[model samples]
Each structure stands twice: as structure tokens, then as C-alpha cells.
Target: MRRFKHLFFLLLVITLVPMTSCDDDDDDVEPSRMDLLTAGEWSGFAIFVNGADVTDFLASDEDEPIDVRTWKLKFNNDGTYTIRGDGVDPSPLQGEWEFTNNEQAIILEGDSPGDTQTVEINKLTSSELFLNMTLEDEDSGTSIDGEIRFRR
Candidate 1:
């Protein structure tokens, strides 16, 4: 009877060991959607109208440029975004945005008609974030494929 009791106790511990070990690993699990969105502020450079670098546009004060439209983009943890440029009003252009998932994508709706933009997040860090986006314009020939790198 003593030997049998010892075997049973050992088997019980073996079964419970795995369960306890799993709990330890739970702390390393992925963060929730809101947790990720609230991680930090993402600010970076952007180009609009294709073929104009952000700096060139800013330098020329919205003069015709090449390869990108110059602007600064800010994304906040509170679900707001801001865009500032020479020819545009920053306040009306700034608004709320939401991530499609915990992954790299978000939908931004502006305050004006036909002002919505969809951004695909490329990378994010403590001090910077990168994104790829195309503006909504059917008349334009070339698609606005570009990268935005923002600093905190």
C-alpha cells in the first residue's frame, strides 16, 4: 500500500507540472488590439501627388515637385491622426483612425468629403513607425505607392 501511494502521488505531480508551466508562458503572449494601438505615438514624413519628396514640397511651399507630396503625419494612441502641409488646413485634416487588426493596417476618415485613406503599417518601434498608403484619386495615372517613416 505504501508503494502504491507513492506512485499515485508522483503521477499526480507529473500531470499538474505541465499545467503550472503553461501559466508561466502566458505572460509572453501577444498583446490585445487596443493595447497595441495605445502603444505609442507614430510620426513620420509623407508625400502626396506622386513624384514629389516631402522635403521638396515643403521647401517650395507647395510648388510643383517630384516623386512625392511633402508633409508630416502623426498618429496618436488615442485614435487620432494629424496631417500638416503648406496648402492644407491641419485641423480639419486631422481626425480619428482605427486599426483593422492587431496587424499592420489602419483606416483613417477625414473631416471632408472623399477624405478617407487606408494605410498599411509596415513597421513600428519605440521611436518610429513606417507605413505604405495610396490616396483616393481616380484621375491620377500613377498609384501613390510610398513609405512614411515617423519619429515619436
Candidate 2:
């Protein structure tokens, strides 16, 4: 009985020793969806609609449109976002933003929040953010393919 008890104790210790061992990665938690978003500032690089360049569409009315290169978007860690540029009303379009569908989609809800448009994330990296969205022309009721490209 004594030998049996000692063997049992040894087995138990062996099983638990590895379980409690110090791991270097104990504090290295993978970044969350929100963590990746708030990491940098994104500048509008280009816009395409129905395979057509529309980056200058907003410039049609201006004699000399402010350079669109200055447009910037900053995602806050607090579930909020801000976009400042020549076209964005109020300078900064402050509001909330989130990732859905296991972070495959992004939705931005700013002032006058209407039906949330789920934009598909084409590419999301430390230096770039590419998104695709579909918008319907109200007059034609035809679906239009659109893409928004940004860079950090």
C-alpha cells in the first residue's frame, strides 16, 4: 500500500508539473480586432466605382479641390472613429465603428446613422486597409460596385 501511494503521488506531480511550467508566451496575447484598427492613421488613397475611377468625382464642383491626399481616418481604441478631410462634413466624421462576421466586415456608423452598411474587408494590414461596398443608384435602382482604398 505504501509503494502504491508513492507511485500515485509521483504520477500526479509529473502530470501537473508541465501544466504549471513557465511559458514565455504567457503575456503575449494575440491582438484583438479593435487593436489592429487603432494602430495607425489611414489616408484615402483611391476610390473606384463600377470599375471606374471616382476619386475626382467630388472635385467636379470645386474650382481647385483641396488635395484629397490629406484625407485621414483614425480609429480610436474606444470603439470610435474619426475621419477628417475636404469632403467630410464637420471636418472629422466622428462616430462608432466595428468589425463583424469574425472581423471579415467593417461597419461605420457616424452622425445620421441610417441602415448600417456592412463593407467587406478586402485587405487589412498594418500599412493598408482595402474595403469593398455596394451602393445602389437611387434613380436607376441599379447596384453599383464600389471600392475604397486606404493606406497607413
Candidate 3:
């Protein structure tokens, strides 16, 4: 009976020692950039053009103001994205997105031939994303340099 008691105690310690010695730091490991970007849906928070605030207006129209508060832009892990809102063309914009420039930039290819856009990533965090893009104003034949900020 004493031998049995000691054997049981030894077995319990052996089993618990490995379990307690595990490196718990694995739980604190930070997520990668791709993991952060695709974690959830993001919406427009602000837009700037040529150093001017333009979040309330359409990129091509100064007379009309667009309420971008309802917009939803989602980046998926499968390299696809969808943008929907009051001002988005074709109701919802669907496209394929890819990370470029060593993951420092992003390129979006939309349905139309002229819908290709390359935007530099100004910032990317778990909750916020900022992109700098150079867009051409088709009506004015001028380039529009801007930053678009999004939040999750």
C-alpha cells in the first residue's frame, strides 16, 4: 500500500511537470501584418487629397458631399476585397488585392481595365490602416495625390 501511494504521487508529478513547464510566451506572440489586415472589416474614417480634407465629398464632385460613414471595405485572406457604400460605383466594388513592395504597398485590380490602382501603405495596425495613392481625375486630366484612412 505504501509503494502504491508513492508510485501514484510520482506519476502525478511527472505528468504535471511537463504541462507547467510549457512556454506560455506563445500566447503573447504578435500577429503578422497579413493577419492584422484581414482580421476584420474596415470602414473609411477619413480621406485627404492634395493635403486637403475631402472625406465628405466625392473625389470627382465638389458640389456634392458623400457621407462615407456607412461605407464598408473588407479585405479577405484570399486576396479579394469588397467595398460598398453610397458613393461606391456599381453599387459594390469587388476586386482582387495583393501586397507589393515587400508588403509596404497594395495593388487592387477591379473589374474594369482602368480600375487598377497601386497604393502605398502609410500605416497598418490591428485597428487602423492608412494608404497613400495617386489617382487620376478623369474629368480634369489631373493627378490626385491623397491618403485614405480606415478603421476596423
Candidate 4:
């Protein structure tokens, strides 16, 4: 009887041990890139055009320097975004955005057919975002590279 009791206790422990060790929170899913992008609003802090700092010149007047730091972009989970600020190009622009190239790039489409732009994502984190793009003039076929930095 004593030996039988010992065996039963050992079996019970073995069974219950795995049950207790098993994770109950299996549904805790990790956030995806879309989640990160749509989490908060982003503000533009810097802009580079052809390797030159053109942030101040974007919305600046002849006498006063306008800062691009006030530029704001908010991305929605439904593939929509809005840009608002005094110095920001396409200011007060509303657009639809989609991720491409396995989320390495973003294509933005505005109300007009010619407002399409593609930007390559250099880096994206919870706090910072860096994007590079090429702007081409349709008439002259001149292409200019640009970089924009943003922070949340």
C-alpha cells in the first residue's frame, strides 16, 4: 500500500507540473508594423533635399525663417493619413497610404492623380522614422532625392 501511494503521488505531480507550467496567456499577440505606424502622430523635424538641409526653407519667408518642425502626420489603421502644418508641403493634405515592398516603402496618393509619391523607409521605430524619396519633374524628367526625418 505504501509503495502504491508513492507511485500515485509521483504520477500526480508529473501530470500537474506540466499543467501549471503551460502558459495561459497564449493569445498575447505581438504588434505588427501597421500597429506601430498607426499608434501615434508623427512630427517632422528635419528635411534634406539633394543632401542639403532644406527644412527652414520649406515654409520660410524672405525675412522670417519658418520651421518644418511643426509638421504633423497622423496615420490611420485604415490606410489613410493626414498632414497638417504651415511649412509642410501639401499642407492640410488628406491622402490614402499603402505599404509596399514588404512594408519597406509607402505609396501616398492624394486627391489629384499627379499627387502620387513613393517613399522608401530607411528606419522605423517607436520613437523615430526616417524616409527617403525621389521627386521627379514630369516635364523635365529631372529627379531629386530627398530625406525626411520624423519623431513621435
Candidate 5:
């Protein structure tokens, strides 16, 4: 009777094993980059144009090198962002920002439509944000492709 009971128990265990399932939905889900961008404020990391230093232009009328730490960017949950200068320039540019191209690019809208830009996101993390923008320098009358990096 004991042997028969053991045999029945083994059969029950075998039958239950196939009924068990493991869920992986959580593991398959990817965290959104937009969520990370809106996580906190970020400061300028670096700015380059055509493989040259053009960050001096980031400031409006400053003779000194712009202190990157003073520049700020804040992305909000409402799909809006704010850009501020470090007082590094006499007239620092500040404006609104948004994600476009299905969240693949960021559009920084200046006071006028002609001053707006659509930048591709190279990388975005809790601590770092990298972007590439093609811009036309109204003063220089030259088209420029630039890379801008920021850090938290």
C-alpha cells in the first residue's frame, strides 16, 4: 500500500509539472528613453560644429569660455523642455523643446519658426544626453552639422 501511494504521488507530480507556466512579459518590456530624459535636469557636456569648437557661439556676447555647468535643460513629462544659458552669454538663448519623428528626434523651437531645429537623439540616459543637429548660421551664412552633449 505504501509503494502504491508513492507511485500515485509520483504520477501527480509529473502531471502538475506540465501545467506550470513562467511569465516573461516584464522581462520583455523595455524602458522608455523619454522617461529617462524627463527624469531630471541636465547641463551641457560639449558642443561641436563641423568637428570644430563652436560652443563659444552658444553664448550671445561673452568673451569667456562658456561654463557648461551653468547651461541647463529640463525635460518635462508633458513633452515640453526648457533650455537656459549659464549667464555665459549676454543674451543667452532659452526656449521650448519637444520630441518628434516618433520620438526619434528632438525639436527645439525658438521664438520664431525660422529659428527652430530638429535634432536626432544620439544617446539618452539618466545622466547623459547626446544629440546631433543640422543648423544654418544666419551670421556666417554657412550650414553646420553639430553634436551637442549634456549631462545630469
Candidate 6:
């Protein structure tokens, strides 16, 4: 009986030892989501309506027609972003953005009275950024493809 009791106690310790070790390892590991995004001001030029060239949306020249479809995005280090454009009515949309698990896509949550949209980050650079968005028409249930580029 004494020997059997000792064996049971030994088995219990062995089982608990691994669990405790695993807990310690988890404490030392970093969060997976935190590693996905690089905090900074990502600005660049963007095309309109999936076009291939950069238009004069941001140009200061009076001769250039005001293209309200262009947007400039500023991603801050604090996990917030501001989107300014004339395409979607009232202009300038304020929201928070984050990279998806794979770090290849971004999810944006717009503030009050704004709809949320997920954007695919196609290309990124210090001075240039490119992305695509599919806008859905609520009344017609039609989807339109759009592209945007930004230059800092």
C-alpha cells in the first residue's frame, strides 16, 4: 500500500510539472496580433476608380479639376487613422484600423454614422501606398471596384 501511494503521488507531480512549465512559456511569449502592424504614418498617392496612373487629386494647381474621389490616409501610432476624401459625401472619415492576422489585409472601423470596410493593402512603401476597395451599392446591391494610392 505504501509503495502504491508513492507511485500515485509521483504520477501527479509529473502531470502538474508540464502544465506549470507551459504556463511559464506562455507568459514569455509575445502577442501574435501585436507583431502584425508597424506603427507609423503611412501616406502615399492613390489612383481613382482602379486606374493605373496617379491623378492630380492633391495638386494645388487651379487648372486641375477637383477630383473628389481621391483619399489620403494617415495611420497613427496610437492605432487610429484618418481618411480624408471627397468621394463619400461629408468628406473626411475618421476611424481605427488594424492589420489582419496574416498582415496582408487591413480592417477599418469607421466612427459614428460611417460604415466599416475592409481594404486589401496591395503595396506599401515609405512614400507610396496602394490599396483596393469594393464599394457596394445599398440600393442596387451592385459592387464597384475602386483603387487608391497615396504619396507622402
- TM-scores, all candidates, are 0.53, 0.64, 0.75, 0.69, 0.63, 0.54
> What is the Å distance of residue 31 in model 2 from its true position?
4.4
Residue-by-residue lDDT tens digits, candidate 6, 11-103 = 999999887775665579553433323434444344566464535643343543335345556776577778665454445777788887487
Candidate lDDT (C-alpha), each: 0.62, 0.78, 0.84, 0.84, 0.74, 0.63
**Which sections of candidate 3 miss by over 4 Å?**
1-23, 57-64
Query: Which portions of model 1 show Cα errors greater than 4 Å?
Result: 1-41, 45-72, 87-92, 135-142
Q: If both were scored by lDDT, which would come out higher, candidate 1 or candidate 2?
A: 2
How do the candidates rank by TM-score, highest first? 3, 4, 2, 5, 6, 1
Per-residue C-alpha lDDT of model 1 across residues 48-145, encoded as one tens digit per residue: 33545554544464443322234456667677877774444453268788887566688888877777778887766555566777633244565657
Worst 10 residues of 3 by lDDT: 59-68
TM-score head-to-head 2 vs 3, winner = 3
Superior candidate under lDDT, 3 versus 5? 3
Candidates ranked by lDDT: 3, 4, 2, 5, 6, 1
Candidate 3 residue-wise lDDT, 1-152, digit = tens: 99999999999999999988968877797888899889999888788877788776663465544556667889899999998886677669999999999999989999988889988999999989988987565568899788888898
Off by over 4 Å in 5: 1-29, 50-69, 87-95
Provide the lowest-lDDT 10-residue window in model 1.
61-70
Better of 3 and 6 by lDDT: 3
Model 4 weakest lDDT span, ten residues long: 59-68
How far off is residue 40 in model 2, in Å? 1.4
lDDT by residue (1-152, candidate 5, tens digit) is: 99999999999999988777565664785558777888888888677877776666665445444545467878787756667776433345655777888888988766656867788998887788988977565557898788878998
- lDDT by residue (tens digit), candidate 2, 78-114: 7888889986667877878888999999788877749
* Model 6 clashing residue pairs (backbone): 44-150, 44-151, 45-149, 45-150, 45-151, 46-149, 46-150
